[model samples]
Target: MTTTTEPTARPRTHKRVPAAPNRARKNPTRKRGPGSYAVIAAVTVFVLAFLSPFAIILVNSFKTGADYRANGSLSLPEQWNWSVIGDVWERVEFTQKLINSIQISLGVVLIAVVLALFNAYAIGIGRVRWRTAFLVFFLGVNVLPQEGLVYPIYYLFKEMGLYDGKLGYTILVGITYSAFGTYLLSSVFSSFPKELIEAASLDGAGRWTILWRIVLPMSWPTLSVMCVFFFVWSWNEFLYPLVLLISNDNQTVPLGLSVLQGQYSSDPTSMSAAALLGVIPMIVFFLIFQRSLTRGLTAGAVK
Candidate 1:
């Protein structure tokens, strides 16, 4: 009994333990919520709404004129007249017009790209004196009503002996109207890391070399976007060509298509066919460059 009492005399001391790790504290903002599904649904609806117009156009393109007029644009053709497409091809000189459009569009793309590259470099990398002033001047021209320029441009071209069936029309249009492209490309150029240019210079690269090899390669996405836009604009341009070129053969596809429309006035089928022919190439071009366009937009946005 004495031994047991002696052993019990020493009291046991308790040791404290550290608290459990706070799992929720790791990333508190990542907690799931109810509104996410609503956002997803809204985006889905918006995309579908955007797609509906193109869907209608494509559907209508396939329809026969009678079927279209009778059943409406929403309905499919009772018979897909593949021959009508051929008929249109023969009458509209589709190949020639398409080639002409391609040539004009490509010319515009090349000229726009060249001018935009230089202007963007000057504004973005060089930061030349009065850069902002120059940029503002271009912006003013871009935003100003085309009606204001029409009379002046016409008068100037006439004065310079650059009017009517001259390649000058294409060149002048490409060069003078390039300010908008410059503004757009300048934004992308501004976003590029200046360190790349500095490093290139440090390695004994000339400005031209760096621009061609380093900057151009890295700037493909934005450049591709601008190219597509310029090409589309040039290809679709009607008024400018109409005003600039007086000769029938000098006319671009857009103007030529109007002529073709008159020639095929009695044939709605032929008109529809010609319309399809005119549009298909553009659709093809879009499909080809769509990835680049999307990539460019996303890159520009994120940067």
Candidate 2:
């Protein structure tokens, strides 16, 4: 029958093909190039630049009076003057001034945050008719230079019998500065979702509850940042405390540090020691909250 149908199609022969190996299994390590070296070099340079001043200060802090005077600002200390720190501690009363600064900074941060949060809530989430006007007024305060306002503020404090004491003077200064903080936080609050408030309200939560529970939790990043800013500002505030607060007994750290410099001008070693002591707390604070500061500063900028 026609040669048995072409030998039954040669039994339909099939070829076996091997499975492809996984691409991920081959050379999982990434290759480094000139770009990686460039990045490393750039990072090293930046780190050195940032640390140079600190190194200078640290080395100077440990130097003897003669060494500090003879050697340059960049020179290393020949002998460790460990006693310089104790000499500064007693002469400057660093601990007392530190306590005073800490109290004032903490108070200012607390008051500023509270006022700012509430003001921001009102302007941003609330349906108040004067929201825009209030926002503008607050913004105006920020534009006015603190230097220009110093004279007027000092005179006002002098007239109002609020210039000398610890609590009243510090509180008033913080209140005056609170306006700018309020404006900043208000901008953050404005960016919050309205649905959050509405949802809270619908769930039988009051305004205060919504603010404390919902708004404050979400606003932590902003609050943390503002706290750090206010703390640093109030801590380093020299001119205001110098001009307004007349009592050295109640002097803040900045003023006290200046007084320490005056009292120890002849002792260069002690001066550096005092300066290092003054800077330590601030350095600690910044180190702790620096990440939050960076995050909060850029968090809501996009929208």
Candidate 3:
């Protein structure tokens, strides 16, 4: 019995290791809190506040001059005269002016976007000498008041036989607007993944093919926003068009609106009607591309 007890087993030992670190779970679709709703409500109120004037103009446009003067701008129309819209259309040469605006705006947008994309690619994607200096020079050109350039541009274009018509106006506006577009698109191109371009090049894609197939498709949102910016700017531009286009046929909506004030300065209703009609196209255009505009502007923040 003593010998058996002496042979008792020794105690067993075990090694302990540290546990793995806890990983944080990610939430891609977290629910918004009450504060978010509050913010949305506040923004809605602010937007409504800002747009109230336009709303007033629209409402009063449908009313008689007396209705607005008597009941104030916010009041609904007591008597609707839809004919005022027609009257204004004729007076403003709505058809001609609208056509001019569309032609010039779309033309400027097209030219500017194309030029900006190419220039941006040259500066941002290409290995160019003094690219930074070129960019600075371009942006600096816009630093001075556009009004200051009116005289210089007027003389330059006049001598070059580029003034008076839609083509000339488009070219001028496109070139001027491209100053900003170049800066903007260059930044976008700079941000693009260099690896993609390298990979494409390795796959035997030419520069032209890469631009249309890859760059254009990928940067469509930003490009669309740029188009909108140019469109809005060209549409609202008064000074350049004024100086360049001497005749009524070549003028855009802003100038047409000015004519409205001059002719119907005494009649607020007709003026309002004309203004409302004048801006409808722009409003529609903005609404159509609102999503792309938002996405493009926020792209830098996103990635």
TM-score of each: 0.74, 0.83, 0.81
How far residue 66's Cα lies from its native spot in candidate 3, in Å, is 3.6
lDDT tens readout by residue for model 3, 251-278: 8888887775654356788878978987
CA lDDT of 291 in candidate 3?
Answer: 92
- What are the per-model numbers of colliding residue pairs? 0, 0, 0
Q: Model 1, 247: alpha-carbon shift in Å?
A: 3.2
Reference-based lDDT, each prediction: 0.76, 0.80, 0.85
Residue runs of model 2 more than 4 Å from their true location after superposition: 1-21, 25-39, 262-266, 290-303
Alpha-carbon runs more than 4 Å astray in model 1: 1-75, 260-268, 300-303
Q: Which lDDT tens digits does candidate 1 get at residues 63-131?
A: 677787789767767887677777666665667767767777788788878998899988877788998
Clashing residue pairs in candidate 2, if any?
Answer: none
How many clashing residue pairs are found in candidate 3? Answer: 0
Indicate the residue-level lDDT of 88 in model 1: 61
Candidate 3 matches the true fold with a TM-score of 0.81
Over all chains combined, what TM-score does candidate 2 have? 0.83
Cα deviation at 71, candidate 2, in Å, is 3.4
Model 1 gets an lDDT of 0.76
